[model samples]
Target chain A: MADKLLITSSPHIRAAKTVRSIMLDVVIALVPASVAAVVFFGVKAFGVLAASTISAVLAEYLYEKAVKRPVTVGDLSAVVTGLLLGLTLPPAVPLYVPVVGSAFAIVVAKQVFGGLGTNFVNPALAGRAFVLAAWPLHVTSAWLNPLTMDAATGATPLHAFKGGQAAGSLVDLLIGNRLGSLGETSAIAILLGGAYLLMRGVIDYRIPVAYLGTLGLGVFIFGKPGALFQGDPLRGILLGGAMLGAFFMATDYVTSPVTPKGRTYMGIGAGLITLLIRYWGDYPEGVTYAILLMNLATPLIDKFVVPRYYGYAHDVAARRKANRAGGELS
Target chain B: MQFISILLAGVLTSNFIFMQYLGLCAFVGLSEQFETAIGMSGAVIFVMTFASTVAAAFEQFILVPFGLEYLRTIAYILVIAAFVQLVEIFLKKTAPSLYKALGIYLPLITTNCAVLGAAMLNVKNQYGILWGTVNGLAGALGWSLAIVIFAGIRERWKFMNIPEVLKGFPLALISTGLMSLGFLGFSGLFKTILK
Candidate 1:
């Protein structure tokens, strides 16, 4: 009779969602941008994606096996990380770049810190940062023209945008017909993916909304060289990796803040840093570094931005007064 | 404008801990808890600010006048050590609570490379007393920001299932390296604007 009755801890009722399911949803949400990347950048982009994804999975499997831990490759977190890293790269980067980048992401960034959830920074962004630092020339100037697949000789649209010149037509920018990173060119594809994530409740709306909103507002005020409130905010969000970073990278579960208010602060911080780097710094794009910096601040945000207890809905002063009076509320 | 640029450079672009790689001993040692990190930061700020001013004065009145430039490092060290001792004595007499909070870290600042480095930088850049003090304050503030943020991160690691081989310094240094990478965005931040 004792064996027939089952007992468990207080959280006996569990949600059906597992880590694998959530990761699978993320992968599904990324499908639109992935498809758009291949369509625009052609075969080299596809190769880059494949190499990074495969190496990330292989790296995780090998590291876990070597360390005598149970292999977690089946969870598909590695796939999402690898694919995201691949998407952030230029379409014309050397094949070894993605291979090395994804391996570093999985081993050093993810596993060395005790695997996925325990990692302090976003693994994909860390990988991108590592490879960028290692091979700055390849990462920065390896842009390929969409459809033509020819190496782009001129500065990226983001560079031209910084000079207060129009970066191609608004239509081209929206459809990803301009030169840029593999996954950052298409505004429509990224927005579609972001919408899917938002609709499925996989990501909170506050972060993306706050991030893009802050950036848009900032551009409107200070985007032009010698003017205020005359800058083009539409082209601002559509160009470069701002869209990609806002939707996919900044919204990562482990590296971002857990509390709602903390997430909003994270978004605002990332947006401001992006503007600072883009407008004043030497870097042509700031989204990667912006998100990475905010990832570093996530712990501090969580430490300070705690949620209020449900029963104690009043202000802290009132709660303290009640406590001092030694009386229970009727 | 120059003051603002130098201040911004010290705090952000050329941060002593993250970018310039100075004063790592105290950075790694006292970053275990947020409270202690804050304490060390206050002591360093005080020491560094005064140390820079005194060192600059010594450089101008003693070293430059006597053509004793070769004794810059030794002279700066002596001055900084003396200044830290004075601070220790003053804090103990005036603010016992603050003195107690600083604890052993008060004396340890005497050997901190960032303090010496700040003085040397001011001499190298030919900054006078006031500017040297500002640089020192800015550098210490940046160092404090890094350690405080890092302490917060390390506090969270208490709950993490970190592996045995990579427990303390290995993981700490690795995280620091990653953070430095993020700070790299500010590398040439002053290029177009300030120049």
Candidate 2:
């Protein structure tokens, strides 16, 4: 005989498809990048990871407790936030930086806006944004090169572009030997990570393809930078965390658009922002802000871009007439 | 008297949600309803105060002296996070009804930027442990006060007719800006206090 039935909500969908499971998928998706992080940033990547993950988990735990609520630290969302925050930040950022970033991500962006799905912006991105604003020098100043850091540092491909390093080779940018943020350096690793996520169904092609395509198209014609479409389209995708953001972060299901056209618009908007920032704005690589600004517009996009359910939109006259043809419902 | 500075600084001069704009998501998202907003604010204050004290002590005693300051941020975070979890468990087990009231709101606290902000500010300001605790407590209270006030305004806004363009986030952001500017009026008081 079946075990005594435990009753709950209609549909009885297994709650097993939980935030924990999704976060695990994200972790698995990030494995390649984590390995790349180790290869490039050395043991320091581990330090950043450990600090971020631990702080995130702990903060999540304590937060659930003090309010006399159920403990949710075990869900590993905090760990995910911590890890992502760490990945976004420079390797040399102070240890507490990740801790603080993780805490902000989980508590401020994720928890306060209503736990889990309710957050308006991606928590990890928000956390990094806060740190970038508060501690700009700490976050931006420590631009350690992969194999080394010195005169080589002021050599960000974008820097070279802006400062007349436009002649800088695409090969250096792709392999990530140039000066930049830790995990963002290796184009190859980020691309591999994106491919893995795409394969695992962690993301769809709309955001990445749209964002990358739009940015590439935008910069190819207008601005002066290293390797526009004229040189190597692939290099532009690899130089920064563009692939990572396009595939994983910007495409976060909860924080991103739902409908096909809406996500396309989302990608277009993000791409425009990235191009604008990279070409004209102070920062050479503009993945972070691009993703963030798009995140803010997600709800707006959703309002105008609801998916067509069967023949609903096509027979809109019939549906609206049925609901409100005779009498006002509201 | 020094404690008074801590209070004013947290509440006005460097207010958590408004002036510093730390936990903006909750400030905007939760303020749509007053009761829930107040409850959340209360949780933030309680957690922020304790977390600050714990973090400062850990830094001053454990991380700093050992020349492991590089690890202080992570360590402090772990301590604060773990403490939040432990507290959640104890409260849930010992006080079920109270836990239910705070159940949903509790998890929100773990990731609240205001809490982390208070702890970080305590360090940045170079406050001793006692002062740090005071600062954290005051920061949370200040955030609570700010959120409650904003929540009231938003509730009233629900009834008031608004322009189509400035109805939702735009209006809320504008309101927050006004509040932030209003708080700006208090910055001088810190100078006065220091003088």
Candidate 3:
């Protein structure tokens, strides 16, 4: 009789999840926000979304093909990045902005770093930051009114809130009637999508909960113009990209911490930075930089905020007890 | 007030790495290890301060009087290279341990743009010998501060689950970009404070 024995290292058990499946789930969860974006911003929103998504996928394909790496466009990660990048736009950003932004996100931020999993910061945010820096006038002053799709300007709610003024009634802000980024204005829709992801177990509750919770607390504590403990926590939470970012971006597996406690800390730290920027920073919004900065800090967080190894606590206790007994005998 | 502005501008506002975008080769290459970064930073401080003073005096006394001010670049380079060589020899003789720690980076400082840049900037700004020395020292300190902090971040980055393509240089570049963003906060800081 002949017998064959195959040996492998650890990781004896494997899950069925693939990168494709998870990315698909993320894309599905973003549908509500995209739909809401189009509903609020009309065909222009759809144009930006389509342009970004297509350009991102094409950029990834070209990059992989040029570098002789296996094409990973099938993984759908680029699609998710494009979608997120689209949603973060100011709705009036020219068609070329998303195209260029998506290309940058894919080529420089995502592919040049060795593609998807290797990107340090979110590719979408990197692209956004790049464009924001390159064309501050476009990114900053490109806001449009919700229903009319015409140029409407003044201060965004975060700006008004900063100046101790109200941008709209709470209901208008909640139902996504405010002027803001393409997908970020609709707090209710974002919550709907966030709920789906949470229910599907696609994300950890620790990050979003801790993120929004800390942001609300920080805003309430230090948000007032000149006084402490006088800011509107609800308005602060419901106003900007806080909902979208807390649920989606901050929880990016590659960029966020792994362990449970570390994730919580990542969320809270991002929230604190967001509040700091909105209240005290020169820019009116901080979610993008806040999350990006926290992503940069994720490695540090993982290094220091580690979970205890199995049975290590017992080993330490035993060692301590042995040392005590030895001392008594001496 | 003027001295404070100069110091603040060099150390934060016009940082050699983030602001002037000089000496980035060393910044990216030697920033992988904390001890190595500290060692490199020490060499930079010594060479920059010493070279700035020497180059300034040469430009002010020798080049200016001779009507060869356009040769500032070549003169500064020669001065920095000679100074770095002297420091290397002195370090090897007096402090073998530090020489070992700094290794080849000591000689590499001859090409380190921060040193040459500091020397040239001192000339361009037309700073006096004292102000030029302060600026050079502060610029090196700023470079050291940036590298040490980046090294701390990169040291922790080793344990991270970085993607394959972005594992080394690409990740370092992105980290640098984000860091530059953070440093943008220092823009006009002194102006605001003074106002």
Model 3 chain B weakest lDDT span, ten residues long = B186-195
Task: Name the candidate, 1 or 3, with the larger DockQ value.
Answer: 1
Model 2, span B92-164: residue lDDT tens: 9998887777768878877777777778888888997999999998888888877876775565345344546
Query: Which stretches of candidate 3 lie above 4 Å from their native place?
Result: A1-16, A209-218, A260-265, A272-282, A303-305, A310-330, B1-14, B32-35, B42-104, B119-195
TM-score of chain B of 2: 0.91
lDDT for each of the candidates? Answer: 0.87, 0.69, 0.80
Candidate 2, after superposition: displacement of residue A323 in Å? 18
TM-score per prediction, in order, is 0.93, 0.58, 0.76
The sequence of per-residue lDDT tens digits that candidate 3 reaches over residues A1-330 is 011111132221111125667788889899989998999889988999999999999999998888777677877899999999999989888988999999988987767656666566778888887787778888877888998889877878778887888668988887788888988988888888888888878789999999999999988887787899998889889888899999989988877877688889999988987886676556667888888878767656655565665566745554445434322221
Better of 1 and 3 by TM-score: 1
| Tens digits of per-residue lDDT for model 1, A1-330 | 322221243221121125667788889988888898899999999999999999999999999989987677877999999999999999999999999999988998889878877787899999999999999999999989899999989889888887898789988988889898888888898889889889888888989889988998899999998999988988888887999999999999888887788889999999999998999888888899999999989878876766576676546644354333211110
| DockQ for every prediction shown | 0.78, 0.02, 0.17
A26-53 in candidate 2: lDDT tens per residue? 7877777777776777777788888988
Question: lDDT, candidate 2, residue A263?
Answer: 86
Ranking by TM-score: 1, 3, 2
Place model 1 in a CAPRI quality band: medium
lDDT of 1 at A39: 96
DockQ of 1: 0.78
Model 1, B62-116: lDDT tens digits are: 9999999998889889988888888888989999998898857888898799999
lDDT for A289 in candidate 3 is 84
